[model samples]
Target: MSNVELTNMCMIYDRTNNRVLVQERVKSWKGIAFPGGHVEDGESIVESTIREIKEETGLTISELEPCGIIYRFNDQTGDKYFVFNYRTETFSGELLEETDEGRVFWINREELLELKLSDGFKERLPMFFDRKFSEGFGTWNEHNISELKFR
Candidate 1:
């Protein structure tokens, strides 16, 4: 059956020291992905990103700039998924002691790329690093990013 299986968002927070917020998801999928989660009912995309960051990292986002959107299509069933990508450098709050999702903390931008990351996130991390904003569509399996269409 056709359905929007999920709505999620990823955030890239530059702490001004070349560090960013990251989490290694343990409960669900395995890998280091940016701090984010599924969007709840009626919450706007931006709102969901903010809420997810706060819940998962104990950080209150003060500024969020939409960078792009990623649309994932299931290679097997043709189902679709959407993930909003955002970048921010302003926030307030102490880091959470721990999260059920995984360990949340700051890591150097260059060093973070060396860690094991989720497939989709691994492929999209460059976009965030380069600070390029665009819309993208790709297969969900490997996240073969076809091309980034800048808006």
Candidate 2:
């Protein structure tokens, strides 16, 4: 059986403000990015997503609309990584100013591209905003070079 790791990320959009919640991570993968985390064993994907968002942003979210997925494969180890992407305009609770992950806050949707984004996050944005494509596939070699495609 092939080794596969599952994770999730979500775009929490505040339609009223034309902004989205983003985390300025201070952890392994640093920079501005959406809030999410690994799927716990025995937890459903959606359940895990909801839990992660609440933990990371202190906001209880619902009515998630599946956006797309970002998939990566390590050629050297034959391991696969998948990030299930989602976006929602439904959420509640006061947003946390900071967490162990990073500082969480809102940014204007139009200005998203202007900020420094986490690695590979720039390419993944289309998946969150565009409805036509549902996948961002990438293959990484031993050298860490990758070729990505959207479909």
Candidate 3:
């Protein structure tokens, strides 16, 4: 038997300025990722997104647009994980100096592609910034991306 975990994650984008809130995860995940975290046991996806952004970036999320989900596969453990991604442009509060996750900062859209990003994040970059409202799905392994689909 295998166990699956559900995680709620989001990317905070300031559309007006063409920037995004990102974290250089130096400890745990060890890569550049958006500001978000796991969804608690009893929390809804929206609630988890809001709470996680606040905790990780010190910014309170106001609006969230459903983007899609990332389905990750662990070949060694036979475990599957689903990470729900959301897009938000509205938030409040000052950015944090440090977080349990890592150092946080806003990056310009063009420069984001040049940074070393997580495998899944790099594979799904289009979905994060696409203007048309839609959903996306992707499957990835530890070091490589298997497939990516968007609608």
Candidate 4:
């Protein structure tokens, strides 16, 4: 009857510098997450990214390039997570806590896997590094038989 609440997560990266931005979730979350939240009414996905970047990390993306869209499946059931991964070469702003999202940090690519990243982020991050920005989604394969098939 009603549309599920969708989230447009921002996965920021700078491959030339071998860097990416992530946030440490609060105790309840127990993992690191990309800086993003709900897409507000009267705002486009790009607008939401800009607003979220400012609110979460207090950074303004000077040059953002969309890398891809990802499906962050729910841990429980048929629900899904719609994420928009974007690349930014530069950001300028003071980091602050305007929302209850998490603690922000900018780490190099080599360090991402070491962090306690969100459940599906590991599966979705490679695309960004490959500079593959397009329409697509990633999902966990529940069975070995369908491992290579795209659902």
Best-fitting candidate, scored by lDDT: 2
Q: Residues 6-113, candidate 2, lDDT per residue (tens digit)?
A: 999999999899999999989857999999999999998899999999999999999999998888998888889988999999999989999999999899999999
Tens-digit per-residue lDDT, 1-151, candidate 1:
8567545555656666878888888987688888888888888888888889899989898578877777867776767878788888888888895788899878888798799887657667756777654767766455443443344
Better of 2 and 3 by lDDT: 2
lDDT of 3 by residue, 1-151 (tens): 7778878778898888989888988765678988777778889989988998899889998779887776767666677777788888889899997787888999998899888886557867666777442545555566765665666
Clashing pairs counted in every model = 0, 0, 0, 1
Q: After superposition, how far is residue 39 of candidate 3 from its true place, in Å?
A: 1.2
- Residue 70, candidate 3: Cα error in Å is 0.8
Candidates in order have lDDT scores of 0.75, 0.90, 0.79, 0.67
Over 78-150, each residue of candidate 4 has an lDDT whose tens digit, in order, gives 5565666676767777766435777887788888899888755675665567664365544443442111111
Order the candidates by lDDT, highest first — what do you get?
Answer: 2, 3, 1, 4
- TM for every model, in the order presented, reads 0.83, 0.95, 0.83, 0.74
TM-score of 3: 0.83
Task: Select the stronger candidate by lDDT from 1 and 3.
Answer: 3
lDDT for model 2 comes to 0.90
In model 3, pairs of residues that clash are: none
CA lDDT of 148 in candidate 1? Answer: 35
Candidate 1 deviant stretches above 4 angstroms: 75-78, 140-151
lDDT of 4 at 70: 59
